[model samples]
Target: MVCAAMLILDVLSPLLLLSILLPSYGCRAADIPEDATSEFSVRLYHQLQAAGEQDNIIFSPLSVAMALGMVELGARGASLEEIRQVVGFSHLLPGVEFSLLQNLTAALSDDDSHYVIRFANSLFLQEGVTFNPEFLHLVRKYFQADVETVDFSESAAVAEQINNWVENHTESKIRELLSAEDFTSATRLTLVNAVYFRGSWKNQFRPENTRTFSFSRDDGSEVQTLMMYQQGDFYYGEFSDGSQEAGGVYQVLEMPYEGEDMSMMIVLPRQEVPLASLEPIIKAPLLEEWANNVKRQKVEVYLPRFKVEQKIDLKSILQDLGIKHVFTSNADLSAMTDGKDLYIEKAVQKSYLEVTEEGAEGAVGSGMIALTRTLVLYPQVMADHPFFFVIRNRRTGSILFMGRVMTPEVIEPNDHDFDSM
Candidate 1:
């Protein structure tokens, strides 16, 4: 059962892209409790913050959890327990996380009229390898994962086939997901999970109101970008750590998508304060508090259309999180196969996200607010500087994408319209 493994998880949304891959050698269900997964999401974010520094961050926390759940299906002993502890599933009965993952993903993908969400899970095994029947059955039952047999010796062809499958499921948004170097004759199994979502805003931004504006980066530099402006009723709040720490006062704004089941929550610091000063105060409880306290009110918003992409080495991050058994030679994956030689070789995640002016087709904005520096008529969320954001399911509290925007879509100086500003 010893083999090199690659697991890939992909996410696509209005703010889009992330992919991850891990494998092990078993079998294993409940509704996943809301906020049960928050611990893992927040920990992953902190790890990313430490690793990425000031780079723009983006990855689907739910997507990564699902991929791990698939791996947990075949994991046993310490390998399985490590995942449970880190993923916050230790409280559940031995196998309930699988059902929880299925339910959470199902809830998000069920109502497509308001948004487009698709989940694709698959398993690719080397031909002629005998895997436990129970393992395959449970994976199909809980994840509805399609199982295939591939010849890993032909690394290039295997990479091409897997990449094509990823592209097809993601509406062609993510391509070249795997390379020939990622696979070899020693590879045994590769797990793949892909999630795609596209939704329009409930109050869509009018494209005509977009103008070139100056964006300040944390590094003390400025860039010109397309800033979308609007005045509408939205979930807004102002909060602080009750101390001078975290830069005095900060703002939280929740902008819902078409159905309101999913929304992008932006946390902005004061213009004079840097985002780094505010990052340390972020925790799981703070996320819930911000969500609960926001009030619906009219707001003036100037949000830049931005794109962020990053490739993370999950092997290092997971190791840092205390999930080291599966990646070591002492891995216990006997539940997935009858051999003691099975273990995970490598794991990686790459994510991409783009925020644009497009939202729901027929939805109309309330009105446009005039750009002014001194007037404070309404609680305005001016995202002219670096800020953190999360796109999650409102009901399930499942984080679909989490990251920060330091540099927005930068345009050349000639691209700016001084007259419009």
Candidate 2:
């Protein structure tokens, strides 16, 4: 599978811009399971909602973009059922497909949710075969899957070219989301790509003007981390329930991308506590509470500027993480095809992120200006251990993709998704 494309974790509104942009394009839902449609929509909505609640130093408008790409990938005649299955688990991984699917599904009536996704495949070209009228009709309704065939002298060359295109597409958010091993490791034809993005807070930070701050870990050891400080109109709010004897406010940091309508929103607990410890306190309701409650204040904010990178083979972890049924052979995805024997060969997820304040330069005088951009050399939440990741859409309810990385080593050797132990 290709790495995620740029994803934007936008926290605008249910009537977010994307939602308003694409309204209902009716695609009939085939009769089958009860509540499949509703379940899909709820899952998609909650997934993106969850992404908006996470603490992010890495911003990828990948969820929707990647989903769009994959919706396009479906034109290659990748399994229709498998596409649906991949989209379903995408929320767990929060990959780009998950984000785009969220947008595609929003148009379906609550009862016809499954029907909307049924036509999502129409957006791309299937190598040589044209979809039958039933499936083609749905595709014609929601998405126009038009793809052109590219001819290369060698398959390896073609693959590498595709990889290069991906690297460039992501603004190098991924230089080598895939590598040479990616070419050699797959039993089936493999596809690898990435979505890279770097955007500074419209208001930047000065690195030489950095201050050493204490950052606590889950184990209670307070390590000194540079706190990048800036003051702006934040989604500020506070909460009172936690095991730590300290009550903290949720200080939100919004960093937008240079050329996209996407931004990364990080939620820092206003406490000298480890970010890991406050997991239970981080949830959708909490964000809703914070966004709705925090009184705007010109408060002094201290945050550690650190970078983290992680790689993982998410296939196994996903099944273990509450997404077992879809990957199995029995997965029912007739909604994509009128019940084809298509099966998911593999569902793998890999991700990398970095956060830092190195070489950061900007201003913070409690004011607003446009050209305040700081390029931090070292960046993102370090992925040494385990952390949650997702590809989300700015709008809609469809998890196009999802996965988790418990270990980076799995991807380090550049093993493809099918090579997992």
lDDT of every model, 2 decimals: 0.74, 0.33
Poorly placed runs, candidate 1 (over 4 Å): 1-33, 111-113, 359-370, 416-420
User: Cα deviation of 409 in candidate 2 (Å)?
Assistant: 20
RMSD of 1: 6.7
lDDT of 2 by residue, 303-373 (tens): 34434332322234334434443344444334334443333334433434433332122222211222212
What TM-score would each prediction reach against the true structure? 0.90, 0.51
Candidate 1 structure quality by residue, lDDT tens digits, 254-329: 9988767778899999998999899999988898899999999999999987777777777778889989988777
Best by TM-score: 1
Q: Pick out the ten consecutive residues of candidate 1 with the lowest summed lDDT.
A: 21-30
